[model samples]
Target chain A: MVKALVFDAYGTLFDVHSVREKCNEWFPEQGEAISQTWREKQLNYFFLRQLMERYEPFDQVTREALRYACKANDVTLRDEAEEELMEAYLNLDLFEEVEEVLSQLNDKKLVVFSNGSPVMIDPLIDRSDISGYIDDVLSADGVKQYKPVPAAYYYAQQELGIEKEDILFMSSNPWDISGAASFGFRTAWINRNGLPKEELDIQPEVEYENLKGLLEWRD
Target chain B: MVKALVFDAYGTLFDVHSVREKCNEWFPEQGEAISQTWREKQLNYFFLRQLMERYEPFDQVTREALRYACKANDVTLRDEAEEELMEAYLNLDLFEEVEEVLSQLNDKKLVVFSNGSPVMIDPLIDRSDISGYIDDVLSADGVKQYKPVPAAYYYAQQELGIEKEDILFMSSNPWDISGAASFGFRTAWINRNGLPKEELDIQPEVEYENLKGLLEWRD
Candidate 1:
């Protein structure tokens, strides 16, 4: 029954925390703490900016959050190291199953509904060499708002000329699943780490251990 | 140019984490963890719910977040103790300068713009015995949205018949100050713990260590 399959980019297909290795190489012993703080701050700023009605592009949010995280951890983020980390983000390795799963999809019009800015996500998807498999890429900047804002999902619906129920929205993050489902889409969650579902009372139609497991979806 | 004053209730006027003692008592060695997780989850649910377009009243948010936090910390939350902790929330102690500062206000209409439900905020204000000092208590439920939502702030402006520039919004949270300022109100941050300013590019018109220092605002 699903017409279009929409994927969340960060942490679903892209491994965001992979930057920790480069961070470790640069910051030495405190790399993990800084990287952890950076990720947390990055997500926190998205929520904060959305609530405040001040929309910052994902690139700016990432950079500013890194600055704050570095300051918090007493790490001196020199210009080169800062560039190195951000450049590393654009090349985050896909999970082992991502390319294989995309190749196995049988004629579903696949697309990405991402919070990343076009300039950031487009290059990453291209560099990952999986751009050929996806039908289109959608970004929150199309409406100047991020998920799980209803309008963000609505943008995808209007663009594809499909009903919400006709789209299968998937995310590894529990909150994204709840949001897309709450907005009336058929959602499947990739619960890779097997974390407990969020307490929001919303559940996805299917749960998968990894991208490869998505091959089992029938509709 | 300021015509009236609006105060953010939590963490500014009332100490929300004061219920930690009860949490500690019930959870034993995990009291601090339970309390910290509870507070984090509570704020997180606010953003998640807001983004998901699922609104829960502040009191309900508190209960649900507390429940999740207890589960995460591996604490058995019996009904009796759960009620005890939630009830204690409604009786949180006000900072020492709250009443004195409210009392010292000259002629500006004093009001609270809070995320709390009336049931929660009213009793807390009453039990703190500071009901006489304030003019009115406005809850987010009145607008069906919570703080940092521009609509939530604009509701106060419309209710009080004041221009945005004429209302001085004060919140201890740097993010709240940024939001209020971006929404066109003059803001003062009660930086109680001397936290650094957020990187959001909006600065409060004034910063103070406590409510009494609000007396320093000349406008």
Candidate 2:
């Protein structure tokens, strides 16, 4: 009886690592490392900021994370290179199955609920092939809070005008699933990496390898 | 003018990685990897739990983090090995200069304020050589909130009966320093590794290579 499917954007639908090519162009032989560290620190910055009650938009956090990633990887991030790398986030590649699955699930309301700022996520969605399949895009920025914070998910529930139990929230990030599930949404953990589940006491109600598995929920 | 000095226990006064030897004995070459991931995941769990309003005690969080770290590194963690590794946390070695610095700053009230539960941090403090130098130990467990969250620092301040400005909070972790600084405490970042500063908008009042720098602040 789920009426809407809310998907996490960055890792669940978009390939954040797609920026590796641009990063590799700037930092030869270090693109993969920079991208990996950048992604890790990006999430860390969000969690840290949320805990400290210091909320910065995702774009700025992404840039700061890039700067740290570059320094940690021993590469200098030239100003222009940084701008181009940041640009790359706006045009991230969609996961191989995203468009097909979204199209199939179009009868059910499909929404993007993410920690990504609208300035970043809007363009990303519009540029992607699945944009037409999405009914709404919600950003945590609207609430000035990040995911895993109850307020962020509550904001989404309120905006969609849907009951939490009837909204299936999907995220590749375990922490996000923990948050959404704890906030009362029926959760589907899109564990793309097949990695171990986080040891957090809360568990997602369902687990899937990718978005394709999400098609099972479409009514 | 500072009347009290509050310190972060793990990685500030105590070497959290000192558990490497025990980890190595249990898992051989994977010890270093396990310890590093264990520490990183340990902090991540605290931040995640704090954001989700799921407040598990630090000891429980530490144990869960260890379980994930072992699974992540592709090592099998036996039940007995898990208990032994958890035991190592109680007996972590202090940073080389911690005892000397605390001894030198005897005129100042020295306190250990940590995310650790009292059950964990109490024995850790009592067993350490600097036990005689410490005046009080305050734990975030009392507030059921982790550091970087304002409540945790406020708990420390109330317990010590000191004004925020007159308390110099020291930690090797930048996020902890940011939290303490934002809460109005004078902060000293013990940048033992000389890593680049995090891009959080806040900055510590002072930066030092190690505990020895605390001696400089004494009246």
Find the candidate with the highest lDDT and give its number.
2
lDDT tens digits, residues A1-219, model 2? 898899999999999999999998998889999999999999989988898888999999999999999998888888999999999999999999989988888788899999999999999999889989999999999999999899999999999999999999999988899999999999999999998988977899889999888766543
lDDT at B67, model 1 = 89
lDDT over C-alpha atoms for residue B40 of model 2:
88
Error of 1 at A20 (Å): 1.5
Residue A53's lDDT within candidate 2 is 83
Clashes of each: 0, 0
lDDT of 1 by residue, B1-219 (tens): 888888988899998878888888887778778888888888888888988889989888989888888888877789999899999989888988898888889477888888889888888887785788788888878998877789888887888898999998889876677778878899899998777556667788888999888787786
Q: What's the distance in Å from true for residue A14, model 1?
A: 1.3
RMSD of each: 2.3, 1.4
- Best-performing candidate as measured by TM-score: 2
Report the Cα lDDT for residue A95, model 1.
82
